[model samples]
Target: MEGMVVSTDAYASQVGLDVLQDGGNAVDAAIATGFALAVVNPEAGNLGGGGFMIVRNDEGGVFALDHREKAPLAATRDMFLDEEGNVTEASTVGHLSAGVPGTVAGLWEAYRRFGSLTWSRLLQPAIDLAAGFEVRERQVATLVAAQNGIRQFESG
Candidate 1:
């Protein structure tokens, strides 16, 4: 079957296409694309965040995966409130705002159920890109645009 991969980032799309060319199925390609996005499009994709995926098999069976981050068990409804009981930016910025990361688990589960390519094989492209890949002009612009927002955080 002929397959095409599309993503916001060119390098990520190419990684998915490479997986398909290497005899991988759509799920494999998607997995590769997800990893590649994390490396090349960190502004939008990262292991720190969560996402959802829905797959339809050739047999017409549909599978939905929910990998959204969940609030920590100890979190309370007013966790982001300050001593004055006023709302604070605690829940909107910094490490205090982060939920448990779910991307890795979600990707792993998707691979376990639907992936045909070896896990290592699916990851190598992203790894290579991470080790060294030319940053595109568009990516530079995106980073420049995000600098102000990123700088607002203590860790930034």
Candidate 2:
């Protein structure tokens, strides 16, 4: 509160600060902020990566979460390999490149421990955005340029 510069476009930083201002702990703020960012920028800030969290309590109890993601057990060494061991385009796109997700669980733990509001409260902003806004101009242009490819991908 004294002197901190929240980076622009970083919802986590702002959210953490907001939670602190409301007397909530670090975990509460991080969860709220992480959700906001993921919703606003799914193409980039995704729920795909794993993260660890460290916690400190009033009596100096320290807790840690090793929330990192590991490759699926069903995965084989040749999962992305072509017959010749080269990566196939199909392996890198569509369903293949998608990693296991942990964002939801992380957020859930944070909310459970530190959130005062309902889950509905955390999701309202995203709901409002989707139900009532225009795509950005840059996104519109990109879509227009690749309309055929995108259409085919979605339809496929």
Clashes of each: 0, 0
Mind giving the per-residue lDDT tens digits that candidate 2 earns over 46-136? 5787677787766898877766666677878788888898987766666666567776777677677756666765655455555544556
TM-score list, all predictions? 0.90, 0.65
Output the TM-score of candidate 2.
0.65
Off by over 4 Å in 1: 82-86, 149-156
What's the CA RMSD of model 2 in angstroms? 4.0
- The global C-alpha lDDT for each of the candidates, from Candidate 1 onward, is 0.92, 0.61
| Candidate 2: Cα lDDT at 57 | 69
Candidate 1, residue 51: CA error in Å? 0.8
Clashing pairs in 2: none
User: Given candidate 2, what's the lDDT at residue 136?
Assistant: 60
Model 2, which residues run further than 4 Å from truth? 1-15, 113-152
